[model samples]
Target: MSAGLIDVHAHWLPAELFGLPSGSPYGAMRDQDGELFLGDLPLSIRTEAMSDVNAIISDMDAHEISLRALSPPPFAFAVNSSSEDYIDEYNASLSKVVTESTGRLAGLGLTRLDDASAAARQVADIAKAGVLAGVAIPPMLRGASLDVGVLRAVLRSAAQHRLAVLVHPMQLPRPEWSSYYLANLIGNPVETATAVASGILGGVLGELPDLRICFVHGGGCAPAILGRWSHAWQARADVRAGSSIDPRDLFRSAYFDTVTHDLAALELLASHAGEDRILCGTDYPFDMAEPNLPAFVDSTGLDRVALQRSGKAFLGVRVPQTELQ
Candidate 1:
């Protein structure tokens, strides 16, 4: 019952770091004031208080979270911004906040996939500076997959540095899909699924076996379709012309976060991704995610050992001693 409560997937938006009317990968600019404030989080759930260190501690205490690994806003993943100044400013600011939040907070740095090498170097620098556990990169940047030769090198460099990779969807705008609210409902997950799957099927996993990848949003439905993919790979010879890895083989090598709210859904994700591959996440300060997520996860029919192994210990992060305060 007493597991190290590590929220492997949490977020922070220090006002000093990012300004208002921000761009979210979800296709909408967070209006200076909105409920689903930055990153599709609901107002009732995600609050401005997230910017306050003390308030964050209080919220974590209420949820029994011991250590929350803070993820940057998906929009910030473009570490290779149009401006070099952007990269320098973002990294310096991020390093300051993360380094100063010792004992209570840690960060998963974000970088632009388009320039993986530069991003990787920045991540290494951040790691050396301290207070960062990993780096977050989207599957694609400007429509290029991580499987591409250039980007693969970026991934390898990250592995060399022993930095964990958090892969999310790129926040791109699509006017056509806006009408149906598809940007988030389907588009986001679809993006995640495609990027991660491409890296696996493209032989990136085989090439760099030591890479530690944690997929967000329950791997964006990757688990559910893996069997079909595996069957196709075996049934059709050309299905894997360039890559030798069986589709299912790729799934086993990566890690996934249990951000899915549905219990049955979570269980199915675990079944495919496996208990060892699964970790707990709440996507704090987001409306789509509940505040009392740990309780909801506890309510699932998972056994104590399975829960501890899959949810906490495997992530290697300790639970907070008190909620945000």
Candidate 2:
């Protein structure tokens, strides 16, 4: 990179997360080898990137990455029959990783999103953790949209603290999405777009101007498909009749990550979401995540200043003007 990088979309799930013998929200089966099956999803902890912290730090050193904004994988935010302590323990585990990363990691906290009032309290608590960068949420929590009144209080709390809201999808919206793993490849972007749309179309963005949300997965389909959404919004009077603000501009005002893994997609994202509103992201340790994002971003024709500004804006990381190296 010639400078430095901060991977905003990295994960650091402890290998023992599924092994805890407490009140788990979901049923998990552990085999003799410690391989796990949490519901229908299988987890392999033997992977060096997923299991070994030292290996992760060494990789960051090799990649010239100064910091990693770590969050638990999306399943960690599942809203189920889980108790509050379960959530607390998980978030506490997340916080400890940040505290132990030797200033090389920024922790993105996790919170409950099913009920607005409870969600608000959790957001405040996560912010008070002091090392928290922001909170990451599933596109929808227990079928409640991001713009619903059920999430208003949480959003308000986040706005008050200037915490970044990372909108990542957790479930496929349809039953047939399991085919060929289309959900992760295509449904994820669709869900991300849905997340932002819920915010803008439901008036959350207009009501909370101070809120900073960064949609990962290259902003899903929201940025690139703005024209289609705008057209749909314009073509229907009922759609335009409710919103008090221009949904297009509101969506554009949001932040995005450079995780598209395609040069053209990143270009479209920068064009719409603003060049300064993007952060470096690779969806690290996931197969779909960019294998070498810094080099890819460097090749996207963005000069050093633009790159530095975008990274700083999305993650609030201070990039010195005299170059980041």
TM-score of 1: 0.83
> Which lDDT values do the candidates have, in the order given?
0.66, 0.72
> In order, how many clashes per candidate?
22, 0
TM-score of candidate 2 to 2 decimals: 0.88
Candidate 1 per-residue lDDT, tens place, 53-136, comes to: 677777778886666677766665553443345445656655666567666666676554445466567667765765566777
Which regions of candidate 1 are displaced past 4 Å? 20-47, 79-82, 303-325
Relative to the unseen true structure, what is the C-alpha lDDT of residue 184 in candidate 1, on a scale of 0 to 100? 66
Best prediction by lDDT:
2
All models, RMSD in angstroms: 4.1, 2.8
Cα misplacement distance, residue 107 of candidate 1 (Å): 0.7
Best by TM-score: 2
Model 2 C-alpha lDDT per residue in residues 1-325, reported as the tens digit of each score? 3767767887766666654324334454343354445565665433557656787788788776777788766766646633566568767877777778767777777777556788888888887777677888777765666777555667788998778777777645467786888877788988888888888887788888888877888778887778876787888876665476777788777878888878888899888777777777877776677777667877887654565566566656555554564
